[model samples]
Target: MSSIEGRHPDRNLINMPMKQNLVKEKHDASLHLISRDFETCIDVCQKALHVLSSTVDLQQASDHQEEMEEFIVIIVQAYAELDRWQEVLPCITQHYSGIENVSPNVLKVCLLLHAKVQEFSTCSALYNIWTSSREGREVNDSDLEMLLDIYVTQTLLQAGKSSQITEVVQSSQLSQDTKERLIATYSELVRETQLAEETASTTALPDLAHPQNIVDRVVAKGLRALRMMLMWIWSVRPRLSTRTLYSLGGLATLLIIATQGFDTSNRTLEILGNLMEHFIRSKR
Candidate 1:
């Protein structure tokens, strides 16, 4: 063993210079990307990846795998920035066979590229495969969030099936709190969509005599007022003394009492009032 060591030294020591060169090359490629020199970045990354792929030593190759991944990611990004999905798709498919084989960074960029090209079916398929592969497997919070945001929320939303978001979250292995938060976000989105639709309807029909249109306008105005009141409460909260805040709270309660038994034609106002009451009660 001593004789072998004396004759060959350490393989890692011999490969050290090559590794340093590869690292420096990767750094240069990253800098090129930051500088938006996509062409040069692609050239540098591809060359480094090729060199890393050619390494014959198992240990050396393993050591270089991470650097190689970085190279691939850089190349993919450069191609994407250049709007060369024609090349980027092939590059990614050549290296990674499936979602499980891909690094999160590569997956994110490639998914976005697919979506950019209106490849909704491909994105949906990839997401399904990922969910299947990850089933019964434990994932960190960040990864869970990323997958839900990219595949379920943004992708499906763009595909015009965003209503499926809650269903998907319900089926996911996410924690209870995360699922609730995602559902809340989806509800907010639904509310915003309703508001937009209401505005569009009101604009389309200038008839003030229509009862439905009148109700919509009132609901919209009430929503706006509720939002403004909430904002004002939050803004004045810090400046007011506890006694002043209690007085404000008392006045708000009196207002709520005054609103009770008011005409039920505007159900939205009642809902908003209930929400305000619940919020105040929770704060207290």
Candidate 2:
């Protein structure tokens, strides 16, 4: 009984000073955080962490785990406020899972930080967890708008990665506002991509029959435009209207007249023959 009692008191004596120092350190750290002295807060936390490491007692470490976790949360906020997003990633990945109940505000900031760094996948997972957390916080318009804007600004606007956001759109329980914004974004992208495709597949031609186009373009861009028109007709023959077919007759005649001595006889004849075949098929 005497020996056991002696050991317990000795252990308490050894652990007690560290406990007092930890409390003081945390108090100072809290003050630093409140004052926006972020770097100093981190420094105080690190110092306390070193003390915990030196103790190396599993029970002691477990007892103070909550304190350390709080410190890490502050550090994460500090990093985010400083715009050191890359650093926030490792801190979150390391400390986040160990936390039993995460603060919604902090998690929201994490999501936003991931977005700032273009970490789309990471941002998505954090967003799902934050919005779906057991805390039962209602997702406000600002939250929904933030996620949508993240996709629009980072993914679609920058890399044209609309396909990447499809899974999020389908899986997430979005608000009507978000859905509407997504619809608008989708329309914008479709208009843009369609325009790009048209530009690539056809030469931009004003009406060749127009007096101005005939003047400005006939010599400068006429032959190029005619070849594009012929290719366009050939490509869309199955869906061609009679008017478009007649339109092609004009293009074919122009092409033959323009390129007669340009060493393109075989190809020109092939195009003319294809047009004749199409006319015969239409008549039949």
Candidate 3:
């Protein structure tokens, strides 16, 4: 009985100081966090963590595991507020042996952090666990699950891994509407990829018909008039009386002349006049 009492008191004495130190650390850390002093909060947490790590007693360490995890959570928030996301995973993995050992809420935090940094592989792994029936059972918060789904989906999309997203989209617990939207997004991405590939493979030739000078412009105008005339005739041919057909033919001829004669030279008109005179004299 004497030996038992002595061991218990000694153990209590050893744990008592550590508990006091942890309480002080938690208070200071909480103050720093409330004050928006993230750096200071992290420092306090680190100091406490050092002390926690120094405890060799297995029972004491197990007893203080919650405190250690709390410190890590504070550290995670501090790093996140600082925009030092790259350091978050290392900090988390340092305390927890692996992601499997992390609590669901903390694992969710890790997933978001990884997604934020666009770390696809790690984010994907966490996402799988987060949605798993056995290990990833988060509280039945529909909104939170949808939000996580959106984040993970966005990460996969940004990485151009839409094919890999199909499984996730189909298996997710999000509503049918959200799942449909994701599928639509995936289809759009695939279409865009195909279009891009087609565009790249085809050799684009320079357009040769674009008018460069007055002559080219006039020729282009004539070609457009010809096309218009053909279309008009095709549309009206079956509806025309003989008289109407003749009138339409004359109208079409005038239209063609107007388009082609605007830039005609005076020399060409003079030559036409000379030919008329020669024909009249020969007739006389």
Candidate closest to the true structure, highest TM-score? 1
lDDT of 2 by residue, 221-242 (tens): 4445555665566567756666
How many clashing residue pairs are found in candidate 1? Answer: 0
Q: What is the C-alpha RMSD of each candidate to the true structure, in Å?
A: 16.4, 17.7, 16.0
Report the lDDT tens digits of candidate 1 across residue range 100-192: 666556667767778887788888776677667777877666876787778765577778787788888887778899899988987788677
Q: What C-alpha lDDT values do all the predictions have?
A: 0.68, 0.59, 0.63
Model 2 residue runs over 4 Å out of place are: 1-39, 44-74, 80-90, 93-104, 128-142, 189-284
Question: Best candidate, lDDT-wise?
Answer: 1
Please give the lDDT score for candidate 2. 0.59
Q: Which is the better candidate, 1 or 2, if ranked by TM-score? A: 1
Candidate 2: deviation at residue 4, Å? 44
lDDT of 3 by residue, 132-197 (tens): 633345445454455455554557766677676667777777667878887777778777876887
Task: Give the Å error, residue 52, model 1.
Answer: 4.2
Candidates 1 and 3 compared: the better one by TM-score is: 1
TM-score of each: 0.57, 0.36, 0.44
